[model samples]
Target: MFYSNSWTKCLICLIFIASGNAECPKPQVEGNVVLTNEALLMNDFPEGKEATFQCANGYLKEQGSERITCTSGKWSTLELTCKKKDCGAPREKPHLKYEFSEEGTLFGASARAICDKGYQLTGPSYRQCYATGWSGRPRCDVVTCDKPPEIMNGTITEKPGEEFPEYGGVIHYSCNEGYTLIGNKSIECNEDGEYNSLPPECKDVNDIPLKPTATISITTTSSSTVPPTIRDVNDIPLKPTATISITTSSTVPPTIRDVNDIPLKPTATISITTSSTVPPTIRVSGRNNCVGEHDTKSATENAAVVGIVISTVIVALIVLFILYHSYKRKGSYQMGEDPSRTKELLQFQNN
Candidate 1:
């Protein structure tokens, strides 16, 4: 009974002491369990230590802490969170209208910008997939290639088609009918992306006159009016006329008596010629003078004797010429009615 009573006294004293001493307990939350709709959560964080948060899906996290607690046994009621938002960077905007490769998730994907129909892109078309999207905005620029017109011989007033950039494509050339091309017929894009080279030229060849033949010519003689006579072998002259005669011998009667006077009778036929009754003998000349001329008549007896003598002499000369020519040729002398022989004899006699 004494032990039991002492134990009861001690238990009452212990209860009073426990009841008087206040108690501090371990933290109620355990492990890393995230609270609802919170980017970051930390308990009993030191004064200088900090925490960061990030959102999932199409949302982006902000800097700084989402929530914090102290060891003073008091929890923070800041309720701040990393809100999902779009924070564009350098190329995030575009000067010209742009389109992304992906719509909501394009923040990390490449984006391309294109100018409108009449516009062109001034900067790079491709943009990098970045954490803060693209950097600078893309710009659209106007392009014009006002190339000069190409002509072979005519004027190059303006360029053909529309106006494009300086470095354009090829241009064609042509020439007029009488003209011909002497330069490049086509030009193309160059190093500066432009066309160059001089324009084409047109030229003509001079006409040549025909030459004349060498045989065609005119010559002036000593007398301008004296004509030339051109003839063949068919023309000759006519023959000439000549005169000739014959000779004879006969006895003449006694001179005619006057009408009233009596005529003397002829002497008795020269009866007295027989005076010397001896027989008469004639001698022939050695040469045949009969073939030539030996007899003669008194110039007073025959008035026509002169002409007859001349004709006889001419005949004798012709006969002698014939004899000489015949003796030289066939050794025989003869006469005929040929006038050429007579003319030849006459020419010889005259010579």
Candidate 2:
């Protein structure tokens, strides 16, 4: 009896399926469209029933109706068309530029933020487009550097009101008096927000290397009958009572002399006095000392030049005096011969 009942139900289902009275499978449409919530909840759609559709999450309907009908256990042709949603260009920001993906600004597309030269990106580097809009806000900030490093005995020459230096900006450095700069005088801010090189050092001038020292020695002698005071090159006075004597031996006997009918021996005495204080030693240690030594040497060279000039002048004067005397003698001899010649001419005419 149960097999008879099952056979009867199967016969009825076959009759219904043959008559095209069965429900339609889940309705589907092309172009990224999906069934509406009401339609999706229903497990099946009967013939002659309607199903509504809408664009997918990141898609938008372009044209055609969102409703379709099922007939003969099959869905009707869908006239709906959809396209990707567009987010358009990103917001504008200073020093910020945007580069879009291959999909452009459409739905699911991404954009990357780029900063101008000497600038840094502060926010997220990438943004994605969605049905709502772009993802995040990105910004570009100017690159800056902190205050330059300080140097010993040196100072930075900053602008009037500048506290922090920007990228590519330059700062100059200077040393105090009597100090020498040992590195670059100016450093520039780099793209990394730091100085291009380390700060220079200010070293004392005395620390600089010095050339070899030179020593000079000089000797002088003098003989005089009278007691005389002597002075050094600096004009410092010397003792007046010091005496110096020199003796020489000759092959010939010394000549005797008589003064007022009294015979006397040829005896000579000489005295020479020199400064007692020794000359101060000159030490060339630093730049100032070397300059002083150079000045002294120049002074000595100038004095020597002046002495040569004076000697030349004296020699010229002596030559002029001799020439004058010889000219006068020639003129006198010529004058004396003219009178004698006139007397002889008178005697010849009378003959």
Candidate 3:
């Protein structure tokens, strides 16, 4: 029991020593401040609290606190800085338009850039701070085109066939009637400023007259007259008026009668009578000349001309065939022989 009590007392003493007021240890550095350890620890200043960093003869300090302090058994953060070695300047991007406060700043800073009106922007807008320095350079990008195609006296349904920011895009062109297309219907715009095909044109359509044929008919009238008899002088006419009045009648001649019982009629008759009648006149209807009529006339004339041509060709073929047959017949006659006489003579000769 005495040994057990002694052990318990020893344990309590150790606890008291561990909990006593020991001072925090200070950090230590030997070379460039930038290379020094970032964190620190303390042991109640058992080895005495202190921290220090020294640059090489030609180098300088950069970020972080240069010296650290210890209080309440804990050490303050160490001061860290970098000295420039004899290295050349860092790589700079030529095309990027940006502003930087320093060649190299601590991590997590930003850079800004501006693009021309026609061009667009892209890529990371800022640089990140890294152990070596700033990381990730800013970049700029050219904007895509939105301009339309310009047509000469014509129009396109779309300016550029489609939105083409990257490469070859197509467009179409068309012309109105009475004008002919002279070039390609579509063209493609290339990055090189050249269009894929040539421009188009409009031309007048050709007008040609069709074959003509003529038609004629009586369009007017003319008249003629026969002479009439004149009366004698006054004395004889007065005597006749005192004693006589005249009447006249005329009848047409009868046609020949058939043997079958048919009525016989007088050949001709004439009588004197007083009457008057206007002479019978003749009239005619003329052809029409309206627009519809004129068009129909033209069509008819064309049809007649076509028919005449076809008939003429047929007649010519017939005549040629007749002539050819006549020639062949004449040729065959020139080589003809009498087969019957030859056969009779052969039989007689053989007998």
Segments of candidate 2 deviating more than 4 angstroms:
1-22, 159-163, 210-351
Give the Cα lDDT of each candidate: 0.45, 0.73, 0.50
For model 3 the local lDDT of residue 52 reads: 48
Model 3: per-residue lDDT, tens digit, 30-79?
Answer: 56542233333332354235554555443556566666655556667655
Q: What local lDDT does model 1 show for residue 71?
A: 31
Q: Highest lDDT, which number?
A: 2
TM-score, candidate 2, is 0.51
Name the candidate, 1 or 3, with the larger TM-score value.
Answer: 1
| TM values, all candidates | 0.28, 0.51, 0.26
Q: Best to worst by lDDT, what's the order?
A: 2, 3, 1
Of candidates 2 and 1, the better by lDDT: 2
Residue 69 error, candidate 3, Å: 12
Backbone clash tally for model 3?
24
Residues 1-351 of candidate 2 have per-residue lDDT tens digits of 999999999999999887676678887556598889898888878878899999898998899998888888788888888999999998798889999999999999999999999999988999999999999898988788888788999898763245788888888899998887877888888888888898888888666554333222233444444422322223322233444444333233334342112223333333333434233333322323333445555656787898999999999999999988996665442444677786785577568
Q: How does model 1 fare in lDDT?
A: 0.45
Tell me how far the alpha carbon of residue 259 in candidate 2 is from the true structure, in angstroms, after superposition: 76
Question: Could you give me the TM-score of model 1 versus the true structure?
Answer: 0.28
